[model samples]
Target: MPVAIRLADWDTDRDAIRSIREAVFVQEQQVPVDLEWDDQEETSQHFLAYRETTPVATGRLTQGGKIGRMAVQKSSRGCGIGARLLQAICERAKEQNFQQVHLHAQQHAEGFYLQAGFEVEGDVFYEAGIPHIKMVRSLI
Candidate 1:
């Protein structure tokens, strides 16, 4: 079965979204405490997914069409939830008048992002202790 998803509203979702991120990027991935949490989250349209009331994934999108902080719970990996969450975010971007989308994908996820139609645009760089590359796709 496809994973269940829930759209996040910052005012109502900050807790769930933060829990998901803290689990994947901080607790599991060991990303530094300071870097994994950021100020931009307040302004971004964050999406948090729950599987039967358990937070399983989360991501954020900016009004300018950039996607970031996508995380799938370690236990939920291989469920295709990440792709679905991304698709939903892209649709949301279009509904909001965005013409393109951008994300800094972890080096390991470049292929996953590629499968989702994103093309790597620049050299790899380090972010949150992981190697990453910028990826972009047009909404059209």
Candidate 2:
């Protein structure tokens, strides 16, 4: 099924976005609650992927040239929901005239961002006890 992706309101869509992230990041991946809900949500531009009004995925782009907090419901994996979320966030970065977009991709998710045109950079590091690598994509 096709998913509808749109810019999310920080206040209005916060709960739905948080629910999806909490499921994938906190519950599934074991990322800590403190680390998952970093106070940046209010500062970043968030996007949500919905299937007939049910929120299925989410991602966010920061004005500081970073993309983070990406998550898709466990039941919605392998259905292109994550890609849709990433694409929406990248489009928003382009609209904001950013020349490049960067994200600290979890090691397991490196291939996903690579397929989306991001190139791995730097050595691996740990964030919230999970290994991560920096990845970047040119929006030009």
The top-ranked prediction according to TM-score is: 2
- Report every candidate's CA lDDT: 0.87, 0.91
> Model 1 lDDT vs. the true structure?
0.87
- In model 1, the Cα lDDT at residue 70 comes to 94
lDDT, candidate 1, 18-137, per-residue tens:
888888888988999899877787788888777776888999997667899999988888988899999999988988888899999989899999999999998999987799999999
TM-score per prediction, in order, is: 0.93, 0.96
Q: List pairs with backbone clashes in candidate 1.
A: none
- Model 2: lowest-lDDT 10 consecutive positions: 32-41
**Per-residue lDDT of 1-140 in model 2, one digit per residue for the tens?**
77899999999998998899889989988988988887788898988999888999888898797999888888889988898789889888998999999999999999999999999999999999999999999999
Steric collisions counted per model:
0, 0
- Give the clashing residue pairs of candidate 2, or none: none
